[model samples]
Target: MSAEHHPRDRRTARVGLVLFLLTAVLYVATAGYQRVHIDVLSADVGAWRIAATGEPSIDGLDTSSINRSRVDLFSTVHDGRTVIARSPGVVAAGVPAYALRQWVTDAGPDAEDFTTVPPTVTAALLTALSVLLMWGALLRLTTRRRATAAALVFALATPVWSVAADGMWTHTLTVLGVSGMAFGAARDRWLLVGLFGGIAVWGRPHMALVAAALALTCAWVRRRPGIVARVAAVGATLTAGASLWSYWLYGRWSPSGGYAPAPYLSRGAGAQYEFNQTLGGLLRNEAAMWLSLDRGILVWTPVVVVLLPLLVQTWRSQPAWTRALFLAGVGYTLFQGAVAPFHGGDGIYGYRHGLEFLACATPALVVATARVGRRTRVVLTVVIGVQLAAFSLGGVLNRPTLSFRHHWNDNAFVSGLRDVPLLWAWVAISVALVLLLSRMFLREGAREA
Candidate 1:
């Protein structure tokens, strides 16, 4: 609040704003760079949006549902070329209804030929708000300037980078919900926290795991009666929000699907066995690939770097709620990993499902990076630099599509393209420079800490 601190505060604000802008620009560039295509997940949502609203398809292609039941469900509900069953349910109830309705009434070009403009604009706005909320939460947990930098780094991190540019998805929405809850807890705004958590569940039911974890952590910590009551209020609110959609889509009392058998649970004789054999199923079906990729980046390597240890050593080490929230994140991923039907199918880009795990780990990773000694931090940064360089270069050269059909050994990277030595070299150099700068930044952060 003093004059001496004014310049420092201004600088911090500028840095945070710059990071936010960078994220926004990146999404805009990608959205405008290519026409919307059905190859991506969010694009499918766009297609449904168009169909539901009585608009012609962007590419005039109708999607196929393999089973008769699904087709009937879709047809009965999707009469207007839009999805009538589930999505409409969300729009009709809870927070999403508010956001979606607001989106539809706003005058704008139908960028994707559906009711909503291209997800890029809408999602970018959402992602920016999410990141800003994260900054606020971090500020509550630490110094304003340090929290700003940490949050900025988190916004630019790979998990977020992929989601924001790829357009709207449940993850972007979840990010906002999670950040809101985090900020609300920091400020003791229980009801506001409940609202965000509720919205998150409306977006993705899986977030119930996060809410449960927060509640349990609150209880375990012996929080004040009022605070504990408030946390429970958040969980109840989220459950109520999600229930509105689930009941409409499922026509059942339980939308969380706990009462119903999992689709995988009925697929074969093993179906019944699968649910009970959680860890065993994951080991046999998903773990080998999951662990291998986890080792590659975003998990093992970052932990080995000075960051985790540095985070422990920091004067402002994470509190009980923060640690519990992280544990819940881990538990959620593990629970899903154990139960998800993993038959080595089409949706597995370097294990795309793991992105959820990465999101939870990101804040910890940044905090850890901020806590290390300069020399050790430089070493760790170099390691991250190498990995990111590999990832980005591999991305560009291969024009790699993010999906499970293409695995590490698949040589899908530019498999059909003519080899160009000059272009290849240029991309490599660019990747290297980015990594190098990242390393330097980490080293500088270590010294400053």
Candidate 2:
């Protein structure tokens, strides 16, 4: 990297570097806080072993070992062969880690070595990189001060730490893809916009809508018809390749690579797969998502209740493409609410699905925060304090059960206060962050005034 001669730019660069290292360490250290999905935790090892030895099937391995939960990592295919649930995305990301693990353990698929507190080091690193990329994206649109703070919140106070960094969940790709979109759009790089959109689709087939929404909106807003073809073709090619591979592996063409049919626990009952699109139902899901204590954004990240209102207040002020991207995020979120429960899964920290919306509206958010009243700044500080405590509960807290999704609000606070060991650590960290951030923001606000 070239040296930045300007003092201000150099300072920003130094800050970004320090933040990267700090967040990276945080992610790696806390990775074991949550129990990852059985499939996500094991997919890396399974795929690596299969690809390394060029095995056509698992038939050569001990079938007796299937009882150990190792085999649940993959989907069975023809003639006893198997494929990782999400092809070429999550599986592909873990290839290097798998190689590293193999070198360390000197084991193969039959070894049945599995499970750990923090599933994979690589997963944590990827999530850290995602935060760094977000910081860089924010820098392109807003002042260094706001960008850094917003990125810090993105790294610590959000599900990026509690959920994505905890394991090899597919949300890892979602953050990466969304950050790529933010960066590409900010820089007016059409191919990047397309490539990352396609990558997001690979993470969650449902994200195909998000990718298309972003690409088309950008192209139309810019009045560049060629961009539509260029971006669309890129995303289309990627989605098609994944779909074809899905057909080969699971006799299905779904983007989730045959994992789409997996059991999804619904909060509102009718049927497991039911889509309740009524006005009342949609409104209810919207309210539940924003404020419900169990899985609500407010409960997990109170700062968002303050930060996210920027989406509406500053919508008209955002660039055309960014506004469209923000709206696309809203549409995708509502779609998620209609089709399934907003909890994402049984028990997780914060809102997993809100990750995409934040990524999409980051441009607008940065602008809205550029200038704020002192009262708003005070509220922001307190909420950031709450956010720090909420995500920090992961490592010190007990493993959350599937049913604990509903009980999360109660268990998290009550247990933390009651547990002697956790109380000091959790409260200390949060107090330190809130004080540190408050000083920085208040100092900056005074200078501006």
Candidate that would win on TM-score: 2
Error of 2 at 71 (Å): 12
1-449 per-residue lDDT for model 1 (tens digits): 67998886787677667767866665554442233222233333433444344332223333332111222222222223323233321233222432454467553224333332444466666677778777877776655555755665555434454443344545556677777777776676767766776666665567767766766666567555565577667667657755654454445544452124364335355564463355565564455334443222233234334465665675256665566566766676666555553322232222334444555554555555555666775565455443343344332231333344334334322332235445456445644664565555533335432
> For model 1, how big is the CA root-mean-square deviation?
6.3
TM-score, model 2 to reference: 0.83
- State the lDDT at 222 in candidate 1: 57
- Off-target runs (Cα >4 Å) in candidate 2 are 1-11, 55-84, 103-105, 114-119, 260-287, 308-310, 395-411, 418-432, 445-449
Candidate 2, 447: how far from true, in Å? 7.6
lDDT, residue 417, candidate 2:
59
In order, candidate lDDTs are 0.50, 0.67
**lDDT of prediction 2:** 0.67
lDDT, candidate 1, equals 0.50
lDDT for position 244 in model 1: 54
* lDDT digits (tens) for residues 1-449 of candidate 2: 35555776677778878988988888887775234555564555445654456442444555344334433555566545665455546665666666566677775566465334323577788778788878887877776777777888788766778777877677878777888777777777878878888888777777777777877777777788777787788888988877875776567777667575444434345446443535676677677766666566667666656767665677677776667677877787777676666666554655677777766666666677755667887777777776667666653242443344454345444444565566666666786778786686646644421
